[model samples]
Target: MPTYSRFLKEILSGKRDCDVKKMINLTENCSAIILNQMPPKLKDRGSFSIPCAIKTLEIGNALCDLGASVSLMPYSVFTKLEIGDLVPTNITLQLADRSVKYPIGKVEDVPLRVGKFIIPVDFVVLDIDEDAHVPIILGRSFFATAGAIIDVKQGVITLKVGNDSLTFDLTNTMHYPSSPSENCFFVDSLDPLVHDMHEHLLISNDPLDLAILNREGLGNLGVEVAKYKEQ
Candidate 1:
């Protein structure tokens, strides 16, 4: 009989023939991994957006993305809206294509009316060509401020303020234009290089900021970014 160490060394060295078992006991997690019993993969659900307005200007489709650290607005849109004076900022943004972009300026506390809730949003103004379909990117910062609850599986997003809450169904809300010129814009990544100004401008303490919706502007609230109606 070989010693325990010698027996193990022989087995490892293939000097001794070891019996192979057809079945082996495994932990639940291991079994799941080996049997490929993980959650089913889902297709790209496209982007999630909401109808938002800044004062009088109605932004038909504002892309709500979790990938971005800060909200983004185009210079063209900035020029059109009289939300606030563009405050100069040193914060840098890196886009999806790994291209670096310097924002034109920053706008603070712009009242964004979504559904019946009025939430204050800070936007980083960029010089990119405004996508007629989706003009803005509402990043994680806005989500944090708005107390947003996203259900990717069901394609539902609920925004809460204090005790009040509003929900939107993406299936009905996402309408694309039939025009050939309509372009799609997406923010896959964002790298905000923090500076002195960036450090001071943190997420607002009052996340649940809310205001009553004006009945006079109800007509503009229904405007969709795209031209076509989706069934």
Candidate 2:
């Protein structure tokens, strides 16, 4: 073996030892890998859902989607519950596909029974086909009202209400609903149009004018008239 002149000189001079092992520091990641101390790889647990009810009618599973701004309910479900009258809302929803969907109305303070807790939730009623598996989408509004703390790694979700708390294990209870033909959509924008017609519709006591605006005013305002089905 051909040794470098510098190294040979150092070895002969007794300044450096040939058989000495030098210690080097390793990064935390590298040390973990070498020592097999890395965390165990976990598989995708899927979407979080919980069994909730409105009165005696048990809604199968409600998908807890953080991406949605408003808690959404199909008009069909609202009718089935027959809980209360839907108040007219000026808020307009723009979907993920950039399509505008007009909500039928807003249902306020509907009691949602989850486990031992009866929480009040406001839902934006939309005219859309209800999913058999997961009929309702619980968004940030519901989460905030319920005080939801999602633990993605542990696959657990904790819902706190005052001094009480309820935790659901997503690993065991997670719902994997069969993929529907409709693309998954979320509310991307809220009340985009600042038109006078929308404002008038809000305060207009004349049913005839409100009806006319609901039919033609949105289209006339350059807002694309699209149904939730298209989204």
Candidate 3:
């Protein structure tokens, strides 16, 4: 029978008590179940047990990698942070869904908790958003640094270092977003012509033409003058 037909029949027939072992075999045999277990569709939501303490640091209100030669956050997020201020330490971290390995680094003045052992780490903090029930974020910076992968479905967070990947299943926990902030892009000028020119120059490979047109003081008046001459 077709899988959808079986699903529909089950739905119409209502719940029935089934043998546990047989149900397990049936579930294992289901093609849809097998496909859903693939990485992309696997919605392993919620927190898993972590073997090590997650650390945090605030590097001058900017997210910086702990060591030199590390990848830096984009200017958009970096500019908002203050320098030299001891940012919050010791926040919980949720891991990524995929199981790839990467590098790790240390930071200072960060909150670190591992199992029942909480320690302080001098490390840059990573910003991860867990707003949805199945949070899909584990900052690329930290992931690149620490080389970790989080399998929510399996309830494990794996850390890879030097060709070996370590897995940890954190104690089940609830994760939530910190706060909602209104993100706005403020423009100083409301002039349509200025806006159009700005966009054109920004996307244009040869911005020099726009620069020459602007510097020469040839605004729309030049266009009018040319039209009159042509007439």
Candidate 4:
């Protein structure tokens, strides 16, 4: 097993802001971040990092996604397992598409380069559904520790962590959109005045009536509310 001491910094496009504190916690504990259809809610506060594959379009190359997710495992962990030691195990993985159960295991010790950072991670290779054509799926543990921002929009996944950001267009990637009805409409533009007022009222001392705003979608309104509080 080899220890990764170098830290990589890269910028990616089409990223949505994430709570920095939450990200730190995820890295510290080696937890995976799941992007799903339901409204955001925190769970699995503390747990052992699992080795799994990460599938996304913005990843560009197959190696990028593999390196992003499994690097969290310390060098000691890698040494404990051999190529055959890791076997196919059932695990649930979350992606922008659909959540599915897959078999994955720590296959080999591989070095991943993210800008200036070089990390050695235990590669968890697995065969996704028959429809999956990508090489592997990177787990959340590796991604969180990479200190990058992951963005999903218009079927694209982008990762920007550190000073460099990379975008992966999923036009040809293995994607499983949960359902057509699950799609949410995004507002292209909003009046600054209305936006400011809406934000102010939502963050005011009194409870807000978020339901009143029908013009803007609830997701946009909710994000605005969260931004107000975050500020």
Predicted structure with the largest TM-score when compared to the true one? 2
lDDT of 1: 0.80
Q: Which stretches of candidate 3 lie over 4 Å from their true place?
A: 1-44, 47-138, 175-231
Q: List the RMSD of every prediction in angstroms.
A: 22.0, 13.4, 16.9, 27.9
Question: Which consecutive 10 residues in model 3 have the weakest lDDT in total?
Answer: 57-66
Give the better candidate number (3 or 4) by TM-score.
4
lDDT tens digits, residues 37-82, model 4? 3445543221112122322222233423543334222223334333
Model 2 ranges off by over 4 Å? 1-23, 94-98, 178-231
Each prediction's TM-score versus the true structure: 0.62, 0.64, 0.25, 0.27
lDDT of 3 by residue, 132-211 (tens): 23211223444454565765566656666566566654434434332445334574656988889777766654435444
What's the residue-level lDDT of 119 in candidate 1? 92
What's model 4's TM-score? 0.27
The Cα RMSD of model 2 versus the native structure comes to 13.4
Q: Which of candidates 1 and 3 is the stronger one according to lDDT?
A: 1
> Can you rank all candidates by TM-score, best first?
2, 1, 4, 3
Best model number under lDDT: 2
> What ranking emerges by lDDT with the best candidate at the front?
2, 1, 4, 3
TM-score for candidate 1, residues paired by index: 0.62
